[model samples]
Target: MRNSTIDLLKVLASQIIVIHHLLLYTPMSPVLQAEWPALLGLIADEGRYMVQIFLVIGGFLAAQSLLGLLGKARDVAVWPLFKKRYLRLAKPFWVAIAVAVLLGWLSSKIAMHSEISDLPTLAQLLAHVFLLHDIVGVEALSAGVWYVAIDLQLYAVLVLIAWASQKTGQLKFLEPAHALLLLASAMALASLWMWNRNAEHDEWAWYFFGAYGLGVVAHWAQRESKIVLSSLLIACVLGIAMWIEWRERLLLTGVTALLLMNSAQIERFVTLIVQGPVRWLGDISYSVFLIHYGVLVFASSVVIALGLTSVAEMLLAFVATWVVSVAAGWVLHRVVDR
Candidate 1:
């Protein structure tokens, strides 16, 4: 069952991320930055952090679908779940990479925007194909692909933890499922308090697991009996997380989790306002996220080649890029993702 609220958040977050990338990488952005410095800076810099919304939503849905409430844990087929996740992510992702490689090469022929164009070596291609580009120290072929790899890693860890807990005997102080939940929460807290603070470790799943785990806890909160326990768990970890070192991203994560936990009960008027476009955008969002950068690279390179320098030209270029990227993403979804 598709929750209109989840779809709404997904669409909003994905669009912001798309705009954020355009502001960051388009050759035209620097031209306009002089005129609208604050607007461009906020969208380009602060907007990238909207990704925490995606992480939270992904974790919530994963737990709701795969694990269910602890007392009634779903008997998921572990290997098949992982397989479905990989194939679902890989199909669109590999297609996007191919498009990126083609555009990257074509951009090299036209013009190379310093940040937008990077010709891929064989090693880089291999690294990206295996979703190990970050660990392999190969520059990414597309913007935000690292999140795809990290999402998969986080899902695998959650699945394994749930699966392993089922096999173990109950611990002295807890039921087996409770023990499992405790273990997962501990890892999340450790990540929030320790690994997430280090910029060097951003490539790893542990660095983002806290936000993801909050999503899981939020889904578990839906049942009346579990609400207090789940909310307390969230407060304790995120509270400590804030105490350790405050981050706007962590705060956003908390807000997103709380909203998701109560999304089903949102007032009807709000749904009427957002449901239509949000659902449509949500349907194509994965495609939008995967394919937008490739389109941007090609579009920005064209803008550079044409030597379009005016503020008017930059605005036109930015609008054109947004329209084309969304159109391409919609097509990609229809042709490949379905």
Candidate 2:
């Protein structure tokens, strides 16, 4: 059964991210900016924060899926789980990369724009194939590809932690599940207090583990019916972190975690309200995330080549691009992601 609330979050966050990239990377944004600088600036500045929602949701789902394994057996099949995760993330991802590279080449021939990625060297392409583009200092063929790599890394870390917990049951006091929770919480705190504050670590999963960990904890809280304690601890930790140094991203992460902790209560209401088009959007959100950049590059290049420079024309082009992105996402979902 699909969680409507999670779908709603995915739908909203994916659209915002698409718009953020459109504004940040496309040539048409300059014309829109001239007309509504404040609005465009606000989105361009803060829209990237929506990624926190995805990170939290990723961790939440990861925990949810692993709960069965953690509950049933003394040992997790770590390699199998990791392999499944990698294939689930990488299969559609590689397809999207091919689409992006081809579109980038086509876009360049139409108009030379910074959004169009240069031809990737064989090494760079291989790095991308292994999801090591960012770690290896290779340029990504598409925007936001780094997130896919980090998502896989974070899942791997969680899987290893769970496996370790099972092995370390020698700790007479703590059960494997409890130990897993404690270790995850400790890592979250370390990330919130130390790693996340350092920009240098942004490419790594540890830097974003705070937000991701909250989701993991939230899942356990919901499952164990310890919501109050879990919520309070999360709130206090995030509050203190923010008090020391305010970050809107962290604030959003905390909010997302709280909402997810209480998702069961509101799932029915959310499902009632979020239907039809909204549901479809959420269903294809991942596809949109993977394919929108390529569509945007193609759309923008076409607009530029045709000399659509007026405010009205550019605005229309932007709308057209957004619509095409969604449509393309639906197609990708149907063909590849399903």
Candidate 3:
């Protein structure tokens, strides 16, 4: 039940991340960093919204999938469930961390002060080790770790709901839609409180939780009726209007709703467009998201070594990064993921 639309959305979101990282180095041109670094920084500034989209989609799918499983399993056995998820995630994760380290080492000569470490300090290393660098006040880690954290949090929520669903007679006590609404409502209230309290941490929780809940609602929507065309139109309109705010990037949310409503119906056309390398990118996309920044670090150094000094060279660095990321994914799939 792989929806090509979801796969397509995943691939596109990964590219948005790439664009954000690319904006960071736009000032490496020396001239640009001096003359218009502020302007160059704008594109990447939107990276926050881009990351939000990823979080929402990941949250949405994780909840929908796990809840469905829980309804079927009818047990509170968390270990086996945890194991399956752990294997699927950690293998590719560790490989990416290793790659990030190597990149840090190779690019030491020209890296930003924070990244120029043969052995990153205790705090720095631990931040990355736990993917809590940004959370716990260490900003030296790469950008991709945030989504992993969000996914982990949502997974915890999903597992609990699944267990509850089973105990309650699998929708007899409280259906999935009611569960999603309750969760979404709780998250929204928490978000409001956080905003009022001047909390300075992880302001994107509402979007992530809402998206995950939407995903759950979408799953149920398909059973009631078909609404793909209507869902797409609304998602597009809302996504466009809220283009400026993280709270408003519900565009993909709508898309996710439509696809879930018509998962099988859309599969045929989606498969045609999503074929070839597009499908392949989705395979390695997890790796790309995890390690692209670190790969770019080494790539910057290599270009500096060859005395290449053009925007085009920077573009080539992106290519080099994908090569390493793709290879890293291959190794992880074989050794760690298995």
Candidate 4:
């Protein structure tokens, strides 16, 4: 069964990201901005932070799936894991890229805008196909595609770490699982202290490993006998990291990790708040994230073509875009992701 709390976070973050992109890329936003600058500004400024929720949760779920609470490296067939993850992310991603390209071409015929990508070259297309667009310095065809690439990289890193732990498991004092946790914790500290502090590293998984590693640690902590100590150590390390240099994203990651450590409470809380629609949205969140940008670009282009400027007209257009994005996401989930 799916964890309801993780699903809740996914639903909320995915919607916020969709709205954030809408406000960022849509011409209708300027009209709404005139009417409600504060609201628009708030979403534009803070909504990006929702990514931290996904980073933490990705780490949590990856750890749970790959290592389990016991940290057992049952089948560290790294190549198979990597192939499965890449295919899972890339299949829907390729479809979304097609959607983005088609809508971008159509939108250009109506009204040219910077949000629409230029026609991709063969090299750029290949880069995206291999999830190497960021590493190879090619611009993405769709918004938020970088996260998909980074997610794959992070999983590879985790799998490699698990494999290494298995190879070194002959030590009498430390089992492979314990060693895996220690290695992950060490990497997390390095990320939190060094790599994450630099903006230049943002394109890579190492920069985000602190948050991801926190999720891994939180998962293992639940099964450890020294859960309280583990939790305290995590908080103390994060506290020191913040004390050295304050980052709101890191703070959010820390909070997410702490909540995930007590996920039973969170699951209970979300059960009270999450209904059928929310659960459904959460199930299709990946589809929504992939397809919404294309839908938004198309909707905005139509609004621009119609010269929609009135506040009511703009508001209606924005609502229609959101609804259409959700509907498109549902279709993509059914046809591609399912």
C-alpha lDDT of all candidate models, in order: 0.82, 0.90, 0.59, 0.87
Q: List the residue pairs that clash in candidate 2.
A: none
lDDT score, candidate 3? 0.59
User: What shift in Å separates residue 70 of candidate 2 from its native position after superposition?
Assistant: 1.3
- Residue-wise C-alpha lDDT for candidate 3, range 39-112, written one tens digit per residue: 54664566555654565466557666665665465465666776666556655776677777777876776645
Residue 107 alpha-carbon offset, candidate 3, angstroms: 1.6
Ten-residue region with minimum lDDT total, candidate 1? 169-178
Clashing pairs in 4: none
lDDT per residue as tens, model 1, 1-338: 56767888888889999999998888888888888999888988899888999999988888776555345745646799888998888888989999988887888788887755566788988887778999878878899999999998899888887777665634445554555566677887888999998979988899999988888778767744476667667777788888989887898898888888877777464478566666778899999999999899888889989999999999999999998888888988998998
Query: In model 4, what lDDT does residue 250 have?
Result: 80
Ranking of predictions according to TM-score: 2, 4, 1, 3
Which candidate number has the best lDDT? Answer: 2
Root-mean-square deviation of each candidate, in angstroms? 2.3, 1.3, 4.8, 1.6
lDDT of 2 by residue, 251-326 (tens): 8898899889989988989989789999999999999999999999998889989998899998999999999989
| Residue 212, candidate 3: C-alpha displacement in angstroms | 2.1
Per-candidate TM-score against the hidden true structure: 0.92, 0.97, 0.76, 0.96
Better of 1 and 2 by TM-score: 2
- Give lDDT tens digits, candidate 4, residues 1-338: 55777888899899999999999999988888889999888998889999889999998888887676235446688899899999999999999998998999999998877787888999999999999999889988999999999999998999888887776766666777877788999999999998999989888999989989999998887656456787798889999899889987887888888777777656777787778899899989999999999998888789988988899999999999999999999999999999
Which has the better lDDT: candidate 2, or candidate 3? Answer: 2
Error of 1 at 177 (Å): 4.2
